[model samples]
Target: MIRFENVGVRYADTAAPALAGIELTVPEGELCLLAGPSGVGKSTLLNAVSGLVPHFTGGRLTGRVTVAGRDTRTHRPRELADVVGTVGQDPAAHFVTDVVEDELAYGMESLGIAPDVMRRRVEETLDLLGLAELRERPIATLSGGQRQRVAIGSVLTAHPRVLVLDEPTSALDPGAAEEVLAVLQRLVHDLGTTVLLAEHRLERVVQYADLVVLLPAPGAAAVVGGPAEVMAVSPVRPPVVDLARLAGWSPPPLSVRDARRRAGPLRERLAGCSPAPPRQVADAEPVAVVRRLAVRRGRVEALRGVDLTVRPGEAIALMGRNGAGKSTLLGCLTGLHAPTGGSVQVGGAVPHRTAPRELVRRVGLVPQEPRDLLYADTVAGECAAADTDAGAAPGSCRALVGELLSGVPDATHPRDLSEGQRLTLALAVVLTARPPLLLLDEPTRGLDYAAKARLTAHLRSLADAGHAIVLATHDVELAAELADRVVILADGEVVADGPTAEVVVSSPAFAPQVAKVLQPQEWLTVGQVAAALDGGR
Candidate 1:
């Protein structure tokens, strides 16, 4: 059980409190979802629950916060380790050991648990999180999704009464995300654990939440209730809720199955209408070409005999399950990984052979961990450095940042910005070069709906201006909205590649929420159906 009464938090040098007037309660044995826009203090609230707000973060905390009847202000994170397990947004920052198995057991060892008991709990957690195969892998060698699961397992092994997770499923594929959520459901129902999680991919978790907490904006009080009650008025909503609204369904469906059951009439109405056509680009030369591309990392063949091409003004979505070679392929494009065999060319030059200064203008990458691309102490410094490195105008990078994500202070440290804000800054850095080819790995990982929409618009404009964009992502809705082509990879090879609608509509796992609800129809988004209805009327 977690309770907050008149809680307010404000960092030094900030005019307004990051969070204010927050009154919330999470009952025992319930999974409560903290929902809000980016930079809206969702993470701040989670830190408060784990006793890290004022204790470690050096922020001013007001009022009372208690977990399991113990005041958090009195108990530090280490003091509450027996009852509270917290996993932050960045998984790599949480690991203390190099090996997967060791990292999972480190938390328990710190708590001074018996060796035999710790071993048993670690094994149980490995099986629960599907990490058995990765027990011996080095932490640095694991993929983003693998690291995410390991970070969660590291905490889960402690068997804390309360679990706090931030963006738990953002890095996971749909199937893997379901597994994690299912495990949480079991913990709440069978083990009587209190689970509090904040996630932006609402379509994956909203249906499973026992309670939904909506923080409309920074410094605003939160609204807590059933999923449907909160979603009706919440600023951020999942795709299924958008569909229910578009179809004029009363009491909007919270899950795909519920929406599908009532979709008969809407399906009939959209039967004669087709999904929106992909955007057209003027005929131009190929920006990049891969011929029989192959990459081997250690003993694993990360990519195998892959052939692909990107033309000017085109958008491609690289999609697949975890460890399916998506990131490896991106690495080759950015010259981060040397191909074991085959050839890769960007703008008629090999990326691996290109110099760093020249490559910044030819190609750019926004990696999964946005912080890796940032090094300056403040936001303004990073922008200035990007301009110097890219040989761009003095204000170009800052302008891009303002356009993509507004209200970010120039003087704020890059580390202090929220995950989404960091991502936007990284993107601005890459865009400053005006590279002909752009690659993004999981760009929507921490972005809320509004921020994601802004990103989509920016990418569209870039494509129209003759830039090639390729993004490796697990966000199906983003693919549906932005990708002109969908390429699915498996086992280091391309399995399916075609136009967006043709590829995703046929695959149940990759289909968007609207596509699932409007099955037997090919609609992939609420915007498509809304357009059809308006045109028909």
Candidate 2:
């Protein structure tokens, strides 16, 4: 469906070409997984294929690019619209309509399809994506997942043979991410549509992909093959893969199911693989408190009568679907959003009532999108400026920044980095503030297992050091591993709140594989699950 022959693209402002002599092809109905560190021209290649590179972006293009036998240089985005459907990481940026059904119809209407055909396509797409219930809902009122689905559905209505998604699930909760992936699978299997998607959260989606494309960071070589081949040889492997390697297994498990199936023999081979005692944090003073909190965002009541408390040395995972009030609750806790009703207290003082400068010392927030925090030219500079006092050693800040960049996979351009890397950088900058309470919104989004594990370990250490953490995430495994408690919100209400095991395992949408495997045990983290499985073995 798509082909790039010696394709080189250079943006006017940049010294080097965004994409350098990229020779690639996408066969009809083939699902291709494009993997690369952020800013290595993954987006550039996609843009070229979709005719947005030279046409809309105004970049110099060299070499031939073809999609469905049509040359990209000659075709504009609108001209190539019927053959390809493109969705980017940020769905909100692409929204052209305010309503769901209208958004779906926008693409078809542009194609000059008959009104009857447009109506049918919109309805079918809504049903296919499980958006029939939300057809009348305002796009702005929808959750991150719902909005992404709408963006995809709007494009899919065009019945394009090829679908190219640039980290489509970056903003979605785990459940919503799964829904989108499931839709992608269905399209490839049932509808025979070609899919080419780029994502950093390889642990979740890699297993489902037929082929994997691993592009080296900035100045490295690109590798492509079946998922297993590429993932094994890649610099960083997922946790299960690492476990497999540690156990001396030939081929690593790609998914949790694969891990469980292969773990039996591996456990037998590695003796003394017993579970460690659960991490214990000593009781500490309360750093933040929220009681009967109600937060209103535009037309949506994001939080309704929610009560929660975070103590120093506690890592709390807030889980919910997109629009489940996770972000809103975080905003309320961080003083970014004032509670419409109820109260929020940081260090026994109301967050809103606290002075901004004083609040900087008590609480730090890393918003869901990392772009909000990045403005400096270099990663080192961004972290340095996050400090409250001028006397802090620049050497210490630079060291911390370097450590954070090294910890994440493919740390290149702060702006061009993947969602996961950006989140890590943002958190690293926030950490420079030395705030007691750290509020992370979807901190695990777009992270590979290794990156996620490293981050989880860091959060665990932070909690051990008496820093309270409130992480709004869709990752149940992360919650299980790092958070002492899990608070679930649905439709602006705190639907579930308890220990990580209890809340995560009980919630159908947010539960990870291990949680389902050990249903009654309520194990939230991979370590806990590994221990349980070790015991059973």
Candidate 3:
């Protein structure tokens, strides 16, 4: 349904083209996945299919791109709205109306569909995406995952033949992500709708794809084939694929159940071996302390009597389902929102009562929306400003950004950059402060496995240097890699807190793929298995 012929995109004033020599076709009624590292033009390619690359983005498109028999070069996004629906990385930017119901119907209204038809489709989409309860809620009041579902519903309600989505499930929890993926599967199988998805979180979506198109390197042509074939050679892969490679299994499995079927011998080999325990922090003064904290936003009691303590040289993962008060607790630490009751302290000072400049030095926050930490028109400008604000050396933030995601130019605007690239930039900006306490919200939302590895190693080094790390994330693999402790929250309360392996392996909803595949064993990651095989453990 979508065809790219000799397609190459080059943004002005860049060292190399964002995409090069891309030639591929996405057949009708199939789910095609775009897999690649950060800053490799996956988002740019998705934009091209929806006629946003050259028409709205001002980039040069060097080939003919067609969707559903119509040339995107000639048919703009508005003209192709009936045939194609596009949802970008950021959901908040996609909404046109304040309320959920209105937003879902806005797309159908734009197409001049009859009011009755629009209402029917909207109601169907709301039910499909489990958004019926949020039908009348304001967009601004919803959680990150909630807004993502609403954004997808708004597109699905239009009943377009083709759906182009970038990171559709990045903000969603495991269950919610499964619901969205199931909806896409139904659309493809039952309705014969074509889906072209670009997602960094492959663990949730890779197994569901009919075909995988892998961009192995930046500016490289894509390799298209069956999901397993592409993943066998793709550097960016999920934990299950990594495990398959470590076990030397042929035709790597894509799902946990498949891997489990093939993991009998490996599990027996590991029967006598035990994974290393989580790091233990020594007795020391706490970096942040929260005692019986409560926060109420409007009519919702976002957080209720939560207690948490972070000491130096420790990494903690705050995990929960959507609207479980994870973000609210993070806000309390950063002083973005004051507690409704109880006491919250960071570096021995009350966070919400502390001064902005002084508080930033003690604690740095990389928010869920990375763009919230960015304002400059260019990457170089943002880096310079970060250096000035943090009193760090010149170009420190740029160096960090380069390490996290390579091939990002200094002149690229944060808005123009890919979601993963923007996130790395925000992380770099916060790292420049070298704060004692570092907080990240969904830090791995858009990061590929390779980029995520680089980030994990960097954060590990910081933790080793006595910096306390607290991450509010849904990426269980990330928590397995970096977090020494896992804290699960439910409805504004701390439900569980303990060592990473103990907390995650006990909960099926939050368990990583490796742990799920190798049950009865406490192995949290493929790296642990690899290390033991290589005699590193």
Q: Which model scores highest in TM-score?
A: 1
Best model per lDDT: 1
- Candidate structures ordered by lDDT, highest first: 1, 3, 2
- How far does residue 78 in candidate 1 sit from its true spot (Å)? 0.4
Model 2 over residues 1-537: C-alpha lDDT tens digits? Answer: 778777788766565566776777777877899887655677777788899888887789999999899998988888888999999877878899889999999988888999999988888888777899889898877877778889989889999998999888777777677878888898899888999998876756888898877777652445768888887887655555655565555676688777667666644533444335545656666788788888887766778889887888888888777778888887776677888899888876677777877787788898877888888776656656655342366655555555654643222457655565677778777776667899998786666555676777777888888898998877666776787888888888887887766666666777765555334444444555455555766
What is the C-alpha lDDT profile of model 3 across 1-537, one tens digit per residue?
A: 999999999988777888999999999999999998887889899999999988998879898999989998999989999999999999988989999999998888888999989888988998999999889888898889999999999999989999999999999888899999999999999999999999988999999999999987778989999999999999888889989988999899999999999999998888778887667787699999999999999888999989999999999999998889998899999998999999999999998889998898789999999999899999999999999998999989889988998888888888888888889999999998989999999999889888899999999999999999999998989999999999999889999999998899999999999999999888999888987777733
Which ranges of candidate 1 are over 4 A from the true structure? 281-283
Candidate 3 weakest ten by summed lDDT: 528-537
lDDT of 1 by residue, 188-236 (tens): 9999999999999999999999999999888988999999999999899
lDDT of 2 at 237: 55
Can you give the lDDT of residue 336 in candidate 3?
A: 89
lDDT of each: 0.93, 0.75, 0.92
Per-model C-alpha RMSD: 1.1, 3.8, 1.4
My TM-score estimates for the predictions, one after another, are 0.98, 0.87, 0.98
The TM-score of candidate 1 is 0.98
lDDT of 2: 0.75
